[model samples]
Target: MDLQTLTYIIVGLTFVLYIGIAIWSKAGSTKEFYVAGGGVHPVVNGMATAADWMSAASFISLAGIVSFVGYDGSVYLMGWTGGYVLLALCMAPYLRKFGKFTVPDFIGDRYYSQAARTVAVVCAIFICFTYIAGQMRGVGVVFSRFLEVDVETGVFIGMFVVFFYAVLGGMKGITYTQVAQYCVMIFAFMVPAVFISIMMTGHIFPQLGFGSQLIDAAGNSSGVYLLDKLDGLSTELGFNQYTSGVKSTIDVFAITAALMVGTAGLPHVIVRFFTVPKVKDARSSAGWALVFIAIMYTTIPALAAFSRVNMIETINGPEQTGVAYDTAPEWIKNWQKTGLITWDDKNDDGKMFYANDARNEMKIDRDIMVLATPEIADLPAWVIALVAAGGMAAALSTSAGLLLVISTSVSHDLLKKNLMPNISDKKELMFARLAAAIGIIIAGWFGINPPGFVAAVVALAFGLAACSLFPAIIMGIFSKTMNKEGAIAGMVSGLTFTVAYIAYFKFINPEMNNADHWLFGISPEGIGIIGMLVNFGVAILVCKVTTKIPNDVVLMVEAIRFPKGAGDAQDH
Candidate 1:
């Protein structure tokens, strides 16, 4: 079958599968809508959590960014993966033990103040909105390319799909759908990696092939390590060595820290733990989710290398000058259809040359690397179609997760928990569905008019989460003295500081977004670390001066940390 037909068929089937799962697993009550009835098996919830964690940022854009930025992009790999481990080991079980419906609910009740909950709700909505923007954009990118629609049109289509499942099934629907998505995503990613690994290095595993010496079409070793050759080729093209990083050490640390803390604080991922029945199950599912997540994370660097090498070899040809424009591979024209890759023959040599300097003849968006990789390597139409389906799966799954968070924040946290304490469960469910529908529409708009690239936009959301929520949650559970006044003050200050810094550097003045203008040489992406510190410092300081915690609230904190009995605890 033609690539387009295969793509449509495969993508259509996955959508059908997702919708069917959503319909079958539809929530019947407020509890099911919010937490999937709180009876999910650890392994099942783990798979669902993995799908929720690995958005378009992971499956579609991480490799693409790594391919372009080389060693510097390792921060993303380390940050996101490390963050998940942190959440699982340090927070997930405790949050599960707290047994709140949402992050805001946990904060509100833990601090013994509705104000604390409202602040958390606002922050959750803000962070999830920013995060969902990237997923929506990812959906649009896939649709625009594989389905041959306008980017805006693609986003609207994604909005509808996500809206249908998210509004209908709520957490119950999203959880089961995510299990199917995880299977599709991992399969789609690994197949191409294995294919290219064998094609390039005579190895079955891309992870091994990344370091293995290259093999020619005759299956003879070229005697040069893959990374070594990539490094040499990179410098030849006027780019930094592929194995060398250029980001300052401090900035790298800050960005990684921000991402790590932010991942733990992400409301969507945290909610997955609530779906499981027991605290131990939360911990178990977290490990399972990590295993599933690592499958993709480990393959990213290898795929980045393989895709980069293939793209360069195709564009620059054997002689390394350029390829004749007319003779360029079919992949070039295919990507050009999406307007993601373009060429201009400046010198009129009728050849397209890619370089690191201003003389570069092509305008290639980094976001296209992964999608274009299979085509560049001459992978079959079915394999390419599978990737499109996988990308869509990744994008839609995460968007649904984020939309659920937004809805829960509004319907459960803002309304039922605080504003309308007397609301009926049925009415609350209706409001949750309404909130999800509206959230998707807004998210679709952001996707159509995204603020940045998929990964970059997501990084900012991570920063926001890091600054606004991680500190409060940490203190809430660990420090019995944590009060509403301190937590509220910390969240407001930290969030404000991070937003101001990001807005000033990223939006207000993009020209000065350099190390020279940055505070302590920290980029806006890494500023969240500073904001987090500020939050911690301010909250601790306020607690020291505030009135002592209530004995009742103190007792509650003790129980959340250490459940009353041994056998009774398990039964509870």
Candidate 2:
């Protein structure tokens, strides 16, 4: 079958499966809408969480990033994965013990103030929306490429599918649908990776294959290790060695720290724990999430190396001069049409040089490496089709989870709890669905015409979460003296500093977004760590000056810290 036909069959089938699951398990009440009736099995919830956490960024962007930055890209893998350890050990079980419908619920009730709840609701909504914009963009990119549609049309179609399930099924529907998506996306991701790994290094495992010897496109090896060959090629082209990155040790440390803390702080990730049946399940579910996530994360580095080597060999030849532009491969020609890969033949010699020098004749976007890898390796038509489906699964799964977070925050935390407490449960559920539809419309708009600042919003989401939410949640459970005034002040101050710093560098003065202009030489990506510390500092100081928390609030803090007899989670 043709690539387009195969893609339609596979992607169409997955969408049907998602919609069918949504219909079969539609949420019946507010409890189901918020936490899937709070009876989910740990393993099932873990799989759903895996699908939710591994968005298009993890599935599509990570390998592409690895291809360009090589060892420097290890930060993403380590930082993101390490955060789950923190989640499993430090936060998930306790939050599940607190037994609330949302993060803002936990904050507002634990801190004993509606003002604190309102602030958390605002922060959670902002964080989820910022993150959702990227997922919507991922949906658009996948559909535009594989479905042969314009990006706007792709986004609209994606919006419809997500809206159908997320609005109708709620968390109960989403959780089960995500379980199926996990299977589809993980299978699709693994197949292509395994094929490429075997083709490159004669190893069945991509992780082991990445460390094996270099094999030419013709299936012959020069007896050189893959890393050694990559290092030689990179150095010859004026790029850093593939294994030896150029980032300062501290920068790497800082960026990794920010991502790790941010991962722990993200509301979407934290909310997944609320779906499980009990505190033990919350902890176990995180372990399962890591196992599922590890399947893709470990394969990424290998794919990056394999794809990069294939491209270098295709374009630069063994002699290292260049490939004749007119004789470039079909994949190169196809991608060039999309402006993702380009060549100018600068000297009119028709030779395309990919080196870092001024005479270089080719430019390739790092983001296209994984998308183009199948074609570069001459893989089967079905493999390409599966990849398109996989990309959609990743994007749609994450978009659904984030949308639920947005909708629930609006309908439950804001309207029902604070604004309209007399609203009936049925009315609240309807409002949640409406809120989800509205969120999709806004996300679709951003996907079509994403603002300059929107691209940086993901990092800011993490920074905001780390600086604003993580400290409040952690302190509210661990410290009896963490009064409402202290929690509120800390969240506001940290969010203000983090957002202002990000805006000054990223949006207000784009030219000053570099390390030369950074505070303590920390990149904006890593500035969240500083922001996190500021949160701790400000919260402690504010608490020292403010009145002690109510005795009941202190007792509640102690209650959450002890998980013994923490029964099945139920939305209050």
**What is candidate 2's TM-score against the reference?**
0.97
| Model 1 per-residue lDDT tens digits across residues 321-389 | 899989989889878988889898899999889988866898888888777778988999999999999
> What is the alpha-carbon lDDT for the whole of candidate 2?
0.88
Candidate 2 on 326-395: residue-level lDDT in tens? 7877789877766678888778888778887785788998877877888888899899888889889999
Which residue runs of candidate 2 sit more than 4 Å off their true CA positions? 216-221, 453-455, 567-572
Which candidate leads the pack in lDDT?
1
Candidate lDDT values, in order? 0.89, 0.88
